[model samples]
Target: MSEITPELVRHLGELARIRLDDDEVTRLTGQLDAIVDNIAKVSQVATPDVVATSHPIPLENVFRPDTVGEVLTTAQALQNAPDAAGDRFRVTAILGEEQ
Candidate 1:
């Protein structure tokens, strides 16, 4: 089992800019020790032949094919615009630019 000493916790607290009281340090020591021990057990079970994976289940792309279909004409597209220019939608100038 990995030993989480008070000195180690204090050093970590300084690096993280945290001020841990004596009680907090003592509590974290036990919690951190358990976490390290669990990780060590997992490492032992992971052999060279076993493949590493980020997820337990397999994943595949579920997207539809990208194909052109019927499209609206320029007049049809601009029919519902509040303001329309010659062949496009018109809007008030932004960024104070001249027409």
Candidate 2:
């Protein structure tokens, strides 16, 4: 089993800028040791022939084709605007900048 010492935990806490009490450090030592042991077990089972994958199941792009479809005209789009210029929507100037 991998050993997670209190000194290691204290060093890690300092590096991460986290304050861990003595009780927390003691608890984390056992938890981190268990995690490392599990990882070691997994490494033993993972042979070179086995392929690595991010997900258990296969994945593919599910997006629809980008085909051009019927769209609204400028006049139709600007019809609901509170203020409209020649061919676009108009809004109040921001940041004290002149248009």
Candidate 3:
């Protein structure tokens, strides 16, 4: 016996606020039945002793350890700026405010 039927597909379409015509209902019924059969086949192999996993092989992090690195000083960083104000970059007011 098939697990999915045309009536069930039509009911599902109604629940999802979709209008399934007769042809769509007939096609979906067969596709859903095949999906159900595949799921059943997978369930049969998933025994208590078998472990479920997202991947077939083991995975490990490939990132290097986080550590502090050499960086430029404040004066060196602000040397190339067109304008500087007390160890900070200075820019013209952009919000139409009085400087």
Candidate 4:
């Protein structure tokens, strides 16, 4: 039998700052117990000879190799800027502090 009890559920609820009434506590106790039992069953079947996998079937990378492509020059980048200061774009200070 799973070790999940009503007291443990109530304690978890308190730790998470959640207020669980008696009805909710009772309901969650059974649900949590079932989940724990299922996990236990999986653990029993997960032997050293068994291989663990995220997916049942093998997956291959279907993406292109990461390589540098065309990039905009500084002048090309700042061409559409409404305001420019030196070689950078300028906007009004948001924090009301002088630069």
Candidate 5:
């Protein structure tokens, strides 16, 4: 198993844009070292024949049926706008429209 030293911890902290204190660096070093050892064990047993899968269980698409509903009235739609154009809702001029 490869050891995670203080140097490694400092490098990781730099990469992650994190400023770790002495206690945090020491704690993370031990945790990262253990993770590396466990991953090494898993890698050693994983062979070329083994296929990578995104999910463990079967995924089926369950989609809802398309349906229509009643539309809102002009009065309801214009109620939220700060400045409305009569019965219709008015908005600020779009940036790129031509005369």
Candidate 6:
């Protein structure tokens, strides 16, 4: 069994900026030591020949075929103009002069 003392628990709580009652610190210390021992047991396993895998399955791209359709005329493109002053589109006053 791992040794868990009240002084160790108080020190750990102070380091973490936590204020714990004596009873709570005593209980938490035992639990934390148990958890650490269990993790240490897990760390004792050997992995000499195992290859690391980042993801489970492979991926493939799914795409749709290209399409060609009818195009709009230039006159139809500039039909819904709020204010057009020339053969092209027009706008309001400019804030700064062109460079």
lDDT leader: 3
Q: Per-candidate TM vs. native?
A: 0.57, 0.58, 0.61, 0.61, 0.66, 0.46
Write down the worst ten-residue block by lDDT for model 1.
Answer: 1-10
Better of 1 and 3 by TM-score: 3
Clashes of each: 0, 0, 0, 0, 0, 0
Q: Give the least accurate 10-residue stretch of model 6, judged by summed lDDT.
A: 45-54
What is the Å distance of residue 18 in model 3 from its true position? 0.4
The CA lDDT of each predicted structure is 0.91, 0.93, 0.94, 0.93, 0.87, 0.78
Clashing pairs in 6: none
What would the per-residue lDDT of candidate 3 be over residues 10-89, giving only the tens digit for each residue?
99999999999999999999999999999999999999999879999899879988999999999999999999999999
30-76: candidate 4 lDDT, tens digit per residue: 99999999999999999999977899988997998999999999899
Poorly placed runs, candidate 3 (over 4 Å): 64-99
lDDT (Cα, tens digit) per residue for candidate 2, span 1-99: 357899999999999999999999999999998998998889999999999989998899799889999999999999999999899889999998997
Q: What are the per-residue Cα lDDT tens digits for candidate 5 across 43-86?
A: 99899999888999989999999888888888887788898878
Where is model 5 more than 4 Å wrong at Cα?
15-17, 82-99
**Higher-ranked by TM-score: 1 or 6:** 1
- Please list the residue runs of candidate 4 whose C-alpha ends up more than 4 Å from where it truly belongs after superposition: 63-99
Q: Best candidate per TM-score, number? A: 5
Give the root-mean-square deviation of each candidate in angstroms. Answer: 6.6, 5.4, 7.8, 5.1, 3.6, 10.6
Model 6 C-alpha lDDT versus the unseen true structure: 0.78
